[model samples]
Target: MRIYVNEIKITDDSIKCYTEESTEGLQEAGQMLVDSDNYSFAYILDNGQSYSYLIFVQETWSMLHENKGKKIIINDNLELEQFESEFNYILDNIQGNLNYGKEFVSVVEDTFELE
Candidate 1:
């Protein structure tokens, strides 16, 4: 399917929500956050190393699939090059990034259908 960076915003009521950035300003439509049974993520350690992790949410929590998902990576010890490499790899192979740096964040669009 298609993937795009769904920007996160703080609502007036003090809640986090996702919005698409556009010329017309923020269109804070409802987001789809899914708790997938088959998903993988990575964690960057303090020593500049990253370890990948996988999670299975089961079909019971699968209803969350209708909302946006967010993943944030933070590590001051990691170099920009290493961070960028990992970030790009995740975006291209898995999802796309909303922000990148020592604190790389991505809002994934999980549209892949598993038959």
Candidate 2:
């Protein structure tokens, strides 16, 4: 298992959500979580001492396979750095950020795909 600094190991099957100060939109999205499927999520608070990265499992809830999807890391103040920092993780794959943001920006894309 590839464990991150906070003991968090991410995978393709894993979708990540993030929240930070002044980010009312993601703050609200981060509020809702899984209640009950074929998906699992992990919440990792910032550890200013290290780098960070997040994801929503490309198209797990709102993203498809083409769209960049919503940024896994929404907060601006957060300075997370992943070893693999070239890829952009997203909330969806093909889901347009404008479309999803228009009506459900504050709503988490992957809400209940929990394992």
- Give lDDT tens digits, candidate 1, residues 26-91: 111112222322333332222124222211123211222332132221121111224334534444
TM-score quality measure for candidate 2:
0.23
Candidate 1 segments exceeding 4 Å error: 1-40, 44-80, 95-107, 110-115
Question: If scored against the real structure, what TM-score would every candidate get?
Answer: 0.23, 0.23
Clashing residue pairs in candidate 1, if any? 32-66, 32-67, 32-68, 33-64, 33-66, 33-67, 33-68, 34-64, 34-65
Write the residue-wise lDDT of candidate 2 on 10-92 in tens digits. 33543233333233221222221221231323233334443222333323443322223323433433332331122223333
- State how far residue 36 of model 1 sits from its true place (Å): 5.7
Query: Cα deviation of 75 in candidate 1 (Å)?
Result: 6.0
- The lDDT leader among the candidates is 2
